[model samples]
Target: MKTNKIIVGLFYLPMFGLLSCNPQEETTPQYKTIQQAIFASGHMEQEDEYIISATADGTIREFSIREGDYISKGQLLVRIDSDVSNTQLQEARVVYNDAKQNSSANAPQLEQIKSQIDQSKTQLNLDKINYQRYADLRKKNSVSQLEYEKAELQYKASQSSLQVLEKSYKQAQDALQLNADRSLQQVKTQQAILNDYSIQADKDGIVLEVLKKKGELVRKGEVIAKIGSGKNILKLFIAEDDIAKLSIGQEAIVQMNNYPDTTFTASITKILPAFDEAAQSFTVEAAFVNPPQLLLSGTQLQANIKQQGTKKVLVIPSAAVIRGKYVELKNGEEKEIKIGQKSGNWVEVKQGLTEKDIILLPKGKSKEEGVAKPGGE
Candidate 1:
């Protein structure tokens, strides 16, 4: 019976206790408990960091500011040597203006042409009536053959001339229409080129980087500079483990090495549903409800996102939790528990334990066995 009790004690010890002076092929286990809470690792970030790119290909003529220079709305941030583009644009504008003026002038003339055409048709109609009367006289033999032949020739000639004139009028009409279409197109092209040459800032911001140097060639839509307002905001990249616990409007505390004592008050304004593909983090935007005066742009920061869930929780260090599924309880007492949000070195223990429990760390373990070794925490 004493041997049986000792054998049972060996099994209940922290990690698997090697059978102490016991039979071969026998070992004991131990366990422990630990405090649990949700944890995460996140970096502090700025609210706005907008990228500025060029709209068209050109040489960098000039930049209004250097990197880190603060700017405001309506700032002349960058300029391109659009001299070539400008000249081209100017030429285009001249052509467009001339074409539009010509089109407008020709448009009014169309009515005059139509009236002239109507007058010509009326003259042709009068000639036809005269010819018909002459023919009737010839058929009645009232007129001599020579005179009748002359009259018949006159009528035929008039008909042929009218057809020719009509063709010419139609041709003029088509040419004017074509000119109007072409002119309108030229105007739009000039407008686009002119817009490309002038680069004005779209927002009130600071120039973070001058991507292109003066006289350097830049492609349209290529990044010409990086810009952002010195707006007081934090862009925290929360760890995937802790991302689920965060919700919009939850209060957060942001910290930076520059201002350790000063905790910047913030609230979650946005949370990305998807994780960043490269960083494996979820983006969370925080608004500074009570901002410190010292908060500046691009300052590295850390954030403490508060949890609103008030339900009690159990948690332990990952080291204390043996294996993937279980943890060592007090003095080698082993228990199986479900885990929760894992911030960093610590993981939340949701099941099989309570808060403030002192848990033992499973320091070492054999690779082959499911059990872990207790180095005695």
Candidate 2:
């Protein structure tokens, strides 16, 4: 009987050794209400950012405005040295004045033509009177036909001379008027070119950067400064694979790198349809619900956009999930699971597991004994 009892105890001793060797933490899944979300990182950008560029090639003579300066619409930001343009403008003004004077009715050339017209009118009236008198005399046969014929010839010659003079006056006037108009247009063109030397702000904004300093030469279309509308907006880049899951009006929680302790709420305001090759992602824009008191441009941030629906699902410790696909049971069996939603340290188990099923956490993973209660962080 003693030998039979010793063999039984030896058989049970190995079973005890196996139980003691298992050191994994054990926990069970619990029902938790959670919302699905996608994560993305980006930075804050000022709305309506514009690059101020030089319209013409010249050296920047005056650049009083610096970065962070507030500017209003049409405010002069920089003045370029335009000596050549100024000289051309002066010459244009002189030519315009000369043409304007010549086109005027009181010009010397017009005055001379007016005097000739007056003299021609006087001669025409005298010739007409003499011709009419001679015709009356010829009707009464008091004058010879040769005398009346000479008077009529003189009157026709005077009329022809006056007509020629009047035509000459009109032609001269028109030519001068045309010249004046052409000169005036040239003056306006020069004036516009001179205006290009002065760069002005197109809208109210803050100067974000001053790319060109005083005395720096800038070519046409070269960037001189950068301005922003001062209104803050989130410019997020989402992964191409995750972009399709996002939509306008989705809620996003933002944590700025500068304000690490605080989190802000925002809503998706815009989403670009095309993928950005440079960023390797799709662009998304958001508006803050209640923005911070002071916001700076280009502030780095991270955000999580919550999906539309929320439901109660069975969830286990994220540490217990193996390779994001499987979890180990307390009985030393590996169980594969289909996950649905994920929050900080918790993962939702959609299938292959129940609330009654207990899981073993892997080595170095945080292990909570028993079942974890559903609660918000």
Candidate 3:
């Protein structure tokens, strides 16, 4: 009986030890201020970054600018082989010169027309003199009636011929002028097309990348290079769910992958109005308040944008809330609670609990697991 009693005591001792070592922790709700923020991830980009594309189809004859080169507006960056365009331009030039000469005051066609007019005028004067002589002879009965009528008809015919020649000269002049104007327009159009073969920088910037080789074939509208303003800006991609919380002038806490030990501050400057379908997120642009000494383009980063102002409210460890709806009480009962904003492991308790209420931590969790203390972040 003594040995049995000793065994029973050991068993009870083990049970007592197990009961004393409770796994769940207990804490009372405390009043504190919590700030809300939206999480975003993206990369560093040069401000005003844009792709330079080919305007005419041809093999690249010359690519003058290389990566990391500084360029000015109107600087020629590339020249296409343009053998065909050069030929077309030559043809256009030939037509333009011909048209210009033809439209000049001393054009051969006009000169020939003027010479004909001079000859006609001379013949008209001779015919008028003959007709007058015939009329005077007829009045003196020195010429037959047939002879006078013949001279008068010859004078009238000369007058009609002169009028017709003048009209013909005017029509020919107008047609030549019109043809010259049309040809000149065609020349200008061809010249513009030829200019497209020479690609020039549209803005002052740096060449970030060269996409085409010197001998590569380039199609119209194909990208040839990437360019941007040398200044850097942070481009963040925010999820659709959190995009609505973002606004201009908000503060951002940034951590760049290149600078692991440093944290930077930035202010939101722009929010793209449309959603990015490829990325499945919305883009937000921010500028650093005090940028780093050196910045590399396309640097990956993560950030948190402040969504709203701080608020004073009842708070508790997030682990205490069961499935975001209720919490375990100290007396082994579940009490429903309304939660507002959450920051890390801390949550704001809006209703169904008071500062005096004691809450039990969930299973397999403890205060040491990054749970904020009262009045702490």
Candidate 4:
């Protein structure tokens, strides 16, 4: 009985030993196409959208269009209260007209000067004739020397008076011309200011928002409306860590949360040089090559930007690569590896790995657990 018990115990001991030992789980490197991509979250926005602001301060008297309205360049969009501007312009026009009349050849001031000069010329002519007669009488001794001298003095005084009047007239004409020119310039300036009261569209676009309504007081430089150029595009805010992986002209796959089944394709068009402090990310812009039919501005979306094109390379599951620089063998031996491009699920083995190499999964995980299944099954 003792010998039979010992044999049974020995058999059970071997069974326990076999049960305690764990089998080695291994995976081989694969020669497959690997793509390097970066994940980003962003929204859709019009590439040419901009804000329209008031040029002059006034209350909005009328709005020619509303939100979602298509408008053209130079179309009047709003009319501010122009009572003050109109009054100013009218006053300026009156002043300008007065100055213009004064500057004209038939002006009352010029006419008065001409009439005075004509009268002075007539008096001078009479004085000259009298002086000539007085000189003849003095030579013949028919009139006194005092009479001839008085006639000469009268003629000389008349000549001086006429010259003075002509000079004064010319001076008056010059002054009137200067005043007219100044008033005309003021009128032109006033007219320009009045035009500011009528706000017109600077470019052809769709009105997305009307910030100031009728009768609302708008200050100069205040935003009154938001306009969009009617072209829809995607705007993304990529994390600073992932910015280095992106470049212009790379392909991007876009997916919107609202439309789960649909996917859109785009290509990177612009990368802003400055970082957006508010979003804590870098701004990037893309245009759709094959866009969704009903994409609207301000729609939220997620995108995966492919950084590198697909290439046939030695690849392994990300879990099989330890600390990104080495891989563990099935025999518990670690080997240093040089890796290159990496995606979320896999990493490219640039050197120190090949398809023939057998790598171990992390401890306690089975081959099926750590290995990326074939065809992502």
| TM-score of each predicted structure versus truth | 0.58, 0.70, 0.67, 0.62
Tens digits of per-residue lDDT for model 2 on 109-223?
9999999999999999999999999999999999999999999999999999999999999999999999999999999999999999998999999998888899899999999
Model 2 stretches astray by more than 4 angstroms: 1-35, 239-244, 272-281, 308-377
Error of 2 at 249 (Å): 2.3
> How would you order the candidates by TM-score, starting with the best?
2, 3, 4, 1
- Alpha-carbon shift of residue 116 in model 3 (angstroms): 1.5
lDDT of 4 by residue, 145-262 (tens): 8999999999999999999999989999999999999998999899999988888887898888878898899899999998888678788888898887788999877766555445
State the lDDT of candidate 1 residue by residue for 123-214, as single tens digits.
77887787778778988988888887776777777677767767766776678667757766776776677676667777777676677777
Q: 12-104, model 3: which lDDT tens digit per residue?
A: 744665777646666777777767667677889997889989999989999899988999999999999888988888898898889888977
Where is model 3 more than 4 Å wrong at Cα?
1-35, 132-149, 308-377
Give the range where candidate 4 is weakest over 10 consecutive residues by summed lDDT. Answer: 368-377
Each model's lDDT: 0.62, 0.84, 0.82, 0.79
TM-score, prediction 1:
0.58
